[model samples]
Target chain A: MSKVSDFFAEFVRRNGATISVYLFTAVIFWIAVLIVLPQLYMLDFSFRFNLPPSKIGTEEDVHTLKNYKYLLFGAEGNPNAFNWLHLEVFFRTIWAAVLVTILNLVICYPVAYYMTQVISGGKARIFILCLILPFWINEILRAFAFRILFGLNGPINFALVHLGIVPEPVEFIKADIALYTGLAYAYMLLMIFPLYNAIESLDHNQIDAARDLGSPWWRIHWRVVIPHAKPGIASGCTMVFMLTAGALAAPQILGGPSSLWFTQVIYQWFYTGGNWPQGAAYAFVLLTACIVFVLTMMRIFRVSLGEIAK
Target chain B: MSADVELDHLTIRFGNFVALQDANLRIPAGSFFSFLGPSGCGKTTILRAISGFLDPSEGHVRIGGEDMAGIPPNNRPTALIFQNLALFPLMKVWENIAFGLEVRRVPKAQRRERAQELLELIALPNQGEKLVSELSGGQRQRVAIARALAVEPEVLLLDEPLSALDLKLRQHMRTELRAIQQRVGITFIYITHDQGEALIMSDQIAVMSQGVIQQIGSGPEIYENPKTPFVASFVGENNAFTGRVASADANHAAVETHFGALRGRNSAGLKTGDQAILFVRPEILQLGAGTQGNALKSKVLAKEFEGFASHIHLANSQGERHISFSTSQEEALNISPGEEATVHFSPDRAIALPLGELAHE
Candidate 1:
């Protein structure tokens, strides 16, 4: 046993540094190929000529810029080709996503701050648990619950009519705005936790000291607490925005035909229209937009998750 | 600049446990006072109560004759320098010093002028724009003081602010702090358990034990005439002889047992048949020959040379009591262990503690 151990130890001693570097490099290489390559492939397809990405799957395929031009401006109304409607659908989805993200921030910030500061101990734990308990259910089931709650003859309209708040029952499911509520509530936990975690970790002594120095409560929160929680707020906003932008199910379920987003369009192109290249190209373009958006927001906020990790 | 703080029958309790009970104190105006006690002795609690962070259950805290009950910490005319210094790490030195004025919504130019003035006063003039994190520990301590003083509080409360510094720095800071207080003329209430700090810096100190103020007096009074046995034992190194009182009067008490009939001062009220403890400082416990007063025939058990003074531990024939002997006399007594020596202490040098429940195990 000693001889074998000695042989292995000597082998490791001779090549430990090189071996460690090789292992790390191998891991990075695997990640780039398996995880990053697929995403990059979608982006490559988006910039390629008006062809679905499935056809371009090869050991080597030089990408092009025609696919983005085709998506931006409709290529001919070819049998299996890009059309002008996809571009419109993409822009509308982007608008809805931005609106959802803004609304999410407006609603989530106060709730997160309240949970962290106004409440504590067991009651706070229970309240937070309730917020996350719904997350245990599948997304489809949660959306279905919202669908039931917002149905024409559901309790909302029933209670509204009883209170004379609204004279007539409103059809909520078919409207695009009604769909955003489902989206917000579905992703509310995501936005809430990061924000609450950020605000929770804020140095409370700093707040108290500011007040003791005679700063008003509003100024204390605005100047000290908010600045300290900026990283948390930005991170939460980023997560919620990305989640909203990537959503495909909510629009398909609650949105009317007029509110069809880019995700549904990609789905229609691939399965219904049997145009893989166009679908892959559109997917790739969306992925690139996400990366660019992340980079831009990080730079704008002057924040890096790396710094936060430290 | 001068406002006295008074605590009348202050009592504070958290849930079922009482932190301070009937804690009464009157800190004179313009005097540097300190609450000197071990940890959890409720000294910091009293400071907090005086500063309005806490409210007594029954009594009231008054500053400059104003009842501070229900007043928030911000509104009270007192500034507290937190133990950790609590200087805003990310803010510039000037910003930290100007925090109090900024909170009050003072104009930027006026506050900056005041901040620069305070920086010079704290001996950190050029460090105005430097970040607080750049300063050393002692500098941070001075910055904390400056920040607290910027509010122009009538009274300043410091809770073990110098407890974090190393020994040499702590000694230097003691003088610096006292000098600053004198220059500023604000009532400084310092809290510390370190005996040397209380001895040198404070104009008056309240020595505490187990949530109660045992004695309050000047440093000399606390060291020389400690009333309680715990105060005597805690304030400095002393050899204590506990025995049943053989005879007692208003002038003197004689303990019949070990250290036999050692006549000490009239310790207020000590009766015969009651137990009594006599305390003698190591410096007062002398060596070399038969002398008057309280003389003990003992043998040198151990002798340790401590540079300036040699500390000799002496034991009697029965070894009933062991007393430390400190002498700067360079006459090397070549005194080995078991060498018989007679130690003497003047009657006036010994203070007798009346046999009471105040004795700690």
Candidate 2:
């Protein structure tokens, strides 16, 4: 505590009242406008009944748990009013997001390892460019681009049919392939850069030492590389998992008829269903789940919160 | 369990640049051998070749009388301790030590037992439970050594592993490394740029420069009887005189220089009028006109006091030649800076060699 005070005192002494006041106000404004205000409004909205904008300022409006109750049990007190569909969509979103996270890891780990460790200067730069170039386009446009590629008569199906890999033009977009692939592609830079950052800092001599001690290639990664990259892997997994769960664009553009993402349901409640309270409640639930998942990942990976922050 | 290593006409070249050229050496089993040279002198390249990291562009490296032509590092009967100790920071010390055994499919209980045994050997029996990051620098060095020893490799290679330590710890670890080598009785190949490290720990030393082995000999032989101009200037400090060989013979040569005709033992056999450099160690060059031969009259340019010894700097009347000799005796303190003095050394104490590249200070 004293150390913190000493630091603050030093800071204030270095930059006197005017500059300090400006900096302090900037921080307060940032936290209030960008972070706390949104969360505060969401919290207030989640605990209230679904009131229209005209009725919002009237005495008939009241704070209640009806929105949350509806989320868990549909309408109140009716046993048959259980919203199994919404529950199914909620769980499916979590599971699909997990699958995409794992798939991205499986696909990106080797590429990242190759780019950082195996490849040399110009080649590594080119590989990084390839990873970043597609993301420069707007994400929604990228999803639509993927939609074009995975359509029934798209290039992928055209090649597969012409090559006789499939008998006819396969319906990739209608089979959830476009959605999953698009999700993995959309957030690849997030995953790759973190893993690359962690792995790049490792000394190459450590790998040589393991090899000289008779360890095979696989065991080297398992014992040395992965353990050293835990913080990176945790950060990557948390970000990718949360982004995939909360992602709205790719799900909307490429999702099949049966693929109803939880964010889509939240969108319906807010904009189409005209229930801002219920939308805010669902969004809050997703936010809490993401926070829990991040903490859980940090625990499993044995990385400290401080490490994640880095 | 150790075996001899033979580098038979080994040559390694990266593109047009030659890293090692036709080097041949036989390192006997159970001996501590060192490759001593400055950085980029191909000492590490030779070590890498022996450890199976680099394939010799030509010739062969034979380990334990087996041709190691196609063998990888992990399969070779050799283990290398990297310059940085390279202990796995994530693993406990015991796990790091046991990693090699685990790779060989040793059971967990046995691996742990052996790790414990090796830990005892390294004098860190209780440190096995600690993470590698938790150990001190010296402790980490010992663990790296123990980890290599756990593999029971026929040859143990070290790549300047002590360079990272402080002066005191490095000096201390030199003795510790020598003791461990004596106990294990394995053919240990150590690479170092520090002459003190090579001379103190190695039974045999190979001095290298410019991708070539200058000389291979025991410590005393290398220090006292350096075969090349590079070696004489490299292995230790020496007073050098560049001149023309006035006269030559198999045993002795006279060099004509600004310091006049200086005679020294000539092993390289320079003919008359050939360029040569004469070398004399400070300890051999003494103050006062006590010698019968090879004496020079000069004025003391300056004096440097180093507690136990005082270095008396001298220059000839022509001011073209300068020499410094250190003496720790009480009588030597009588000579002060800017005083006239005569310094002398015996003929055999100095060595003459045909001119070549000198070692950088």
Candidate 3:
């Protein structure tokens, strides 16, 4: 028994480093299985008419090009069923998402600029905390609050009527425009913070030098500050654009029936339509689009991923 | 005259604490003026006020005759090379120099040409393409200066720019800076705590302490004739003998101290029965029997041999303490750590100021 135990102890001690590395790698693999694998399997499921669950692990009795075919072209005129696989929906979602991202940047830049640079240091931190405090609450609560205020008999309409700006109460909720407003509110901080961090790090001496040399204030910002702020603007835009592109909640709740989103179609294909393969293909397409956009941005910056590590 | 940059009773306050109380100065242009003091002595504040970085609470800072009340630091016809040097780290040497011109939106070709000319003027013509971070400490200093002067302002503000350099480099740069100031013929207002730098480079030096100007004069004037106790101790190191005045007249005063009655020439500000302190520079004290003027006979307490000078500590048989005197190592006094010696100094060399303890109280 002593011989056996000594042998086992030596074995354990000799290969400890390799054993620990294997253990860590195994844990990481399973974690990826739990989170990211499901996403891939779910995408495959969304792309098929009725993909077998076995396809996640083994390619058994599962395949389809019809979903991509139907998405790219149109669903053949099957007069009995609803024609939801329309390509125009993809274009509209992307267009609205682009608009939302632009709006997010436009609103956040000035606010972040003022917060980071104009306010003194102690108050700047307080202002940042105040902007972020409301975000700790559920996004759903905030979205519903907007719904309450913008509803038909909401305070917004009441205020307009009392102030005598509008002759009648206007319907604002469940509109496409309302969806844009809600997304902007939801993601304003995301776009603002990185920019604030970037612009705050800019040396004040540079600005003073520019003005001392005869440049006006506007020209200082134009010639110096904005150029230096490009990295922040690019990263913030990417964050907002990618996030808004995948956004489903704001469009689902605040959007009217005419404002149906592309993600809803993907959701339906996965849960209700039982078209796993088609949904996976659609998921793959959106993933590819996001990747292409980000890569294109990198190419435009002419800086390698390694160079822009921060 | 470009030399007269005048402050008309400049008073600066941060909320309630007055940083500068009725600070009035007239810095002659085309000459190097230095504000010298210990840290937090309102020297830098006065420099900033003149540069238009701080608005004085109740006075005018005027260059020539124009009021510089609201003119921004950039808008004022002045250039400040900050203590940190503030050379843009991301820019090349020439680019950093041309930043002022670039702010004017000078054409790129012309700005580069002018920057190269400045780089050559500073004797660093080949360093134009190097990043500022790549330069040595002294080189970065030159780049900061070249960058400031590229704008050709009437007055230049240098806030202890050489304090960061090594001693040998700092001494070398003093000559270089003074030469450049002369070459440019711009009013240079330099601030520093190091007395050597101020003494060597400044045409006029103001010795300040605790928000008040203690004394202002040429280097030798401030050194040889420090009016206040603070000025006497601060301008150059000095040993003080504290005692009450035994007798006084218009030309001189006799002080009764632990060291028998030592009579020294009065500095024109004392009365009898008043407590006073006698100031004597160590170098002015000679160490020989033949060098007797105000001969102080005492026993040597300690002796130290510095390469250039020797310090001899002598304990007065009549006083409560010892006195230190320094002399050249070449001319030898044969006094060791425990021997009787008589150190000599002229009566006129001693400056008598009111007792500092009573003044502080």
Candidate 4:
């Protein structure tokens, strides 16, 4: 009790009472009004059915599970029929997110290792600047840029054709390759920075010691480097997975005609279908899946939440 | 099994900086040899070259009569104990010890048994289940030795492993390391800037200065017969006299200085009129002038009473030259500061060498 008061007293002394009050009020307002209130409202809204404006606030407007039921099964009268289309989109979004997370990890690990251990000084700074330069453009603009690059008449296709490696321009967008590529590129920096921060703290002597002990290059990483970088790997994987699954702009801009992402379904529900409650329920389900994925990853990697936060 | 290591005119360069100049040395099999020098004198570079972590820019390194030019560290017949030990904090102590065997696909049970045996040898038996962080500094030092020995290499390389310990533990580990080397009976190449550690633990010492080996001999030989001014000053405390050779003989030279003409052994072959410096050990300087050899008349500047002996600081009549010598505590107590005195030493106890770079504290 006194310790808590002492900490607050010290904080007040450092910032002055007026500034401390302002800072505390701002944090409270941000958390309660901007974040908690909307999530609470959405939770309540998700449990109730949408009604006519006149029917709202009347006996017809009552809390129910119809929104959730509609997700598992189609329309009211057909109880036996399953909504495989929405379910399939949900599973496919999860699968694609996992693939994107793995792709980002595989692409970022070696680059992170090289940046932290191999190169240094101005060379490292320039290498990192090149990585961050692409992200200076807005994500939506980059998605559009990717769309153009992967197009039939773009430079990629032109090179392939000129090189005589393909019979014709491959349908990258229609094949859904552009969507994955855009998502992977969009979140690559997130994975790389965490991995670099983790690996940079490792002692170079440990690597030399392992080699001196007759360990080959691969075994040295398996036993020493990767284990030391576990927390960073977990943090990067969690960020990439959650962001890829919740992503909307890249998927919509680069997805094929036949492809459907779960977020697209929720967007259609709230706008085209005029059903905000159903969209809220589906959003909560996606959030639940993300939470489970993070927990499972933490378990597999044997890392604590605090360690990952570092 | 043991193997001799030979560095044949090895040289290492980083850009324009020559870290280790053209150097040649042959370490005998099953001998404890040490490279002693100040920091950045290329001692660690030589250790790295022998361990296969570094390739000499010129010449070659041969171990056990085989050229080790292209072989990687993993395939070399050597193990290196890093300065920081570099024990894996993520693994148990036993796992760190048995890692080399594990890489060779040894069975789990056999590896564990071998780790246990090594732990016993290091006098830390049954402590293998703990983490490396749990061990004390001395225990960690022993653990590092065990880890290197677990690979059963023909040679072991140590790079100032005791530099991080406290003075007392550092002294204790010097004996422990020497005992371990004798027990293992392998060619151990140790690198250190601490002369005490090198003299106490090494059977043969190679004193280096500025990437050059100045002298290679036993501790007594290096202390008594340094070939260069740097070696004479670097290995121990000495009072130097700067002068020009007045006269020379086959075994002795007379140098004229501000004090007077001083005669000493002509180890560096100084001819007449050549610039030379005479070095005399402080312990050999007697308080009163003797009937033989060189003598200096000086005034006592200060007297520091150490437990075993007292140091007497003195200066010449003009006060241009300051000299120091140690005497018994009773004798130091009798001598008052600011009093005139004459110190004496035998000719064999001093040596006249061509003047070169002298070490500064």
Candidate 5:
């Protein structure tokens, strides 16, 4: 406790009282008003029953677990009738998020290695600019661009047909390929930056030493590069997984008629169905699952939260 | 078993710049060879070429009398110890040593046992489980050597691995490395800029300058009989006098200098009227006029007592040429600064050679 006070005292001494007070108050305001209050209100609202307009201030308005139970047994119908549709969407969202994270990792690791290790100086600068230039456009615009690019009559299909690789244009959107591709592309920068930061600090001599000692390239990456980049991998995986799971834009813009995302369900409950409490309940469930997934990944990778934070 | 390495007239070029040029060398099996030079002297380029990290633009590299062209570094039967050691920080000491064996699909038990044996070889017994960061600088250096040896390559290349240690430890490791090389009996190719290290640790030393091998010989031979002005000045200290060869012979020459004509052995065989420089080692120059050989009179500028010996700095009467020589402590007791002195040296101890680039202190 004294250490905490000492830290604040040192901060105040360094920044002066007025600046310290202003900074501390700004942080408090951000936590309490912007973040904590909204989450707490949603949490409280998720537990209460959605009462009718006439039940305002009446005894009928009470806290209940109906919104939570509704996720499992829909509409309070026959007891055995399960809400497998919502459950499946929930699991599918999680599985898709995991797949997207893995896909992004597989694509980003080699690029990050190439950037940090192979090409250097002015070439490295230009490569970074090329990577970040696409992100300068808005995310929605990029998603729509992906949708068009993956369309049946898109340039990709035109190339495939001209090349005689396929007789007919591939239905990429209907096959759910466009959605996965869009999600993977959307969060790719998040994965690459962490991996780049990690791999950039590695000494090039270690690779040479491994090669000199007769290690094959694959074993070199497995035993040296991958182990060294574990923390960055964990950080990237957690960020990509959470953002992909809660992602709404790419799924809505690029998803086909049959594809369903859990976020779309929450959006429907809140605005279309006019049920804020149920929407909050579903959102909270998604957040919990995302947290659980991150923890499980951390356990598997054997990385600490502190290391990821670094 | 060790194998001989031969660089058959190799040259390496980067773009238009020549990093190494038409170098030919033969390193005997189980011998410790060193390439000694200042930075950017192409010593490392030669080492890399032999280790298969680089390919010579011309000629070939042969190991055990077989060409090594097109072979990748991993396929080459050579291991390199980097200057920084480059031990894997994430793995235990044993795991780092066993990494190459693991790549060969060796069983886990045998790998661990081999790692233990290597740890003992480096005198780091029971330190197999500690991370690279846990060891000191010298310990990490030993670990790097042990790791390279664990692969059992025909040859081992070291790129100044002891350059990072303190002076005392560097001297200690020099003897330690020589001992290790003898025990293992592998062809060791060592690269360094320190002449002392090259002289102390190598069975043969190649002195290089500006991507060219200036001279190659045993340490004592190179020190006593340097063929070039660069080698004479670089391998050790020498006071040089610039002059024109007034008289010449097969084995001796008389050079006309500002201090009158001084005679010395003509190692480079300069004819009359040719420019030459006479080099005399400080240890051989004695104070006072001598009855034999060559002598020069100069005014003493300063005298520095260096415990066992005293160094007297002097210049000609015109003060245009500076010369320094060391004397015994008792002999120096009679000398003081600003005194006129005569330094003498036998012609046998001094040599005249064609003028070339001299080493800067």
Candidate 6:
């Protein structure tokens, strides 16, 4: 605690008290208004049986575990039963996030490697420009763009039909393909930049030495490049997995009627079903799952939080 | 295993810029050869060519009498120790040394044993399990060498692997590197810009400048009997005199300079009235001369006192030419700055060559 106080003193001494106070207050406001306060309210709301203002005339709704019980089991004291539908959607969301993260890694590794190591000078600038150009548009617009591209009569279906690869225009929006594609494209820059930063700092001579020592192409990447990129991979995977798991726009626009995402269900509970407690409970569950996943990824990849920051 | 390396009329060009041109060289098997030159001299480029990182635009590279055309660096029977040493930072020392064997599908136990053997060879037997980053610079260098040798290639290429070391350690590694090369008995093609390193370690030295090889010979021969003006001024410090040839002969030439006529050995054959430069090493100049051949009459301008010797700077009587020579402290006692001095050197110690580019200080 004193270390933090000392750091605060030093910061104020350097920046002066007024400016320091402004900066500190700005951070506190940001955390409280945007992050901490909302999560705290949600935590409080999750334990309460929320009732409509018109119905609660004399007494307030009491705190209870009934909302959580309904979420975990189905509707009451039948502990032997499970909310299989809700649980399946939650697990599927996590699985799809993991799959998309892996797919982005596989596709972007070579592109990042080529951009950082193979391309030179102005050409490298050009490559970076192309990667950044699509992201200039707002993310929702990009998701909508993916919707058009994967729609029933979109360019992909048109091309497949024209090439005679498919006899008919495929209903891609009726499946999970559109959602996964939009999510992958949405988080691509987050994956590519970190990977590129790590790979670019690598000494080219190490690759030469590996090859000169008779290492084939694949072994060089497996032993040298990937190990060097472990932190980048971990950070990219963690971010993409969290974002994809909690994603709302892409799934809402691209998912079929049967493909109900966890976030959509949470939204329905709060706004449409008029069950704020259940919505808070479901959101907390997703947050917990994401935190567990981030920790697991860090452990499996053998990367520290500090290294991922690099 | 060792093999002879031959570059047959090699030429490499990047667009209009020629990095290396018509470089033909034959390195005998088991010989430790070096390409010595300043930066941008194409020594590393030639090394890259021989190691199969690059292909010559016009000719062939042969290792052990087998053509290396169309072969990539991995397929070539040569290993290169990069300038940075390039040890894998993420791997254990043993894993780094055994990486080559691992790629070849050598069994785990065999790879471990081989890595251990190489660790012993490099005098770091107990350091096999340490990460490459944990070792000192010299230790890392040795690990790099051992890692390259694990594959047992026919030839080893080193691109100034000692350039990163401190002065003391660089000097120490010179002997260690030479000892390792002798022990391995492989054709070692070392590239360095340091003349001391080349002179101390190589059996043969190729002096390069720009994109061309100026001379190729044993160290002493290249130093003492330089065939060109550039070689004479480059390999070591030498006082040069540029003038028009007054008289010519097969063995000797007399050049008329600002200080009148001076005579020296005509190593680069010159006709009468040809432009030439005379080069004399400082150590060979006789102070307070007994009137030997090719004597110079001048006055001392300044003296730089080194521990064992004093370098006396002098100018001709006309003050149009400058000469400098080293003399022992004992002999330099009476020769202070601004005093008259007579210096002489034998014609055999000086070589006159057709004037060309001289080494820049």
- TM-score, each model? 0.86, 0.96, 0.86, 0.97, 0.97, 0.96
The lDDT for every candidate, in the order shown, is 0.80, 0.90, 0.79, 0.91, 0.91, 0.89
Residue by residue across A232-292, what tens digits does model 2's lDDT show?
8888888899999999999999999888999999999999999888999999988898788
Alpha carbon deviation, residue B187, candidate 5 (Å):
0.8
- Tell me the spans in candidate 6 whose CA falls farther than 4 Å from its real position: A54-60, A77-80, B316-322
- DockQ-based class of model 2: high
Worst 10 residues of 2 chain B by lDDT: B315-324
What ordering of candidates by DockQ runs from best to worst?
Answer: 6, 4, 2, 5, 1, 3
lDDT per residue, candidate 4, B121-190, as tens digits?
A: 9999979999999999999999999999999989999999999999999999999999999998999999
DockQ of each: 0.46, 0.87, 0.39, 0.88, 0.87, 0.90
True contacts kept of each: 0.40, 0.95, 0.42, 0.88, 0.88, 0.91
Residue clash pairs of candidate 1: A42-A284, A48-A67, A51-A277, A52-A276, A52-A277, A52-A278, A53-A277
In model 4, the Cα lDDT at residue A210 comes to: 95
**Which 10 residues in a row give candidate 6 chain A its minimum summed lDDT?**
A53-62
Pick by DockQ: 1 or 4, better one: 4
Candidate 4, after superposition: displacement of residue B121 in Å?
A: 1.3
- Candidate 6 lDDT over residue span B1-361, tens digit each: 7999998999999899999988888999999999998899899999999888888988899999999999999989999999998889999999999999999999999999999999999999999989988999999999989998999988999999999999999999999999999999998999998999999999999998888999999999999889888888889888888899999899988888766677888878888999999887888888755565577767788888989888888885457335888888988998987778888778877888899988775
* DockQ-better candidate, 4 vs 5: 4
TM-score of 6: 0.96
Tell me each candidate's i-RMS in Å. 1.7, 0.6, 2.4, 0.6, 0.8, 0.6
Provide the lDDT at B164 for model 1: 96
Q: Which candidate number would show the highest DockQ if scored against the true structure?
A: 6
lDDT of 5 by residue, A110-223 (tens): 999999989888998899899999999999999999988999999889999999999999999998899999999999999999999999888999999898888888988998
**Could you tell me the lDDT of residue B232 within candidate 4?**
88
Which residue window of length 10 is worst by lDDT in model 3 chain B? B352-361
Model 4, residue B350: what's the lDDT?
88
The number of residue pairs in model 2 that clash at the backbone is 0
Q: Considering only chain B, report the TM-score of each candidate against the true chain B.
A: 0.94, 0.96, 0.93, 0.97, 0.96, 0.96
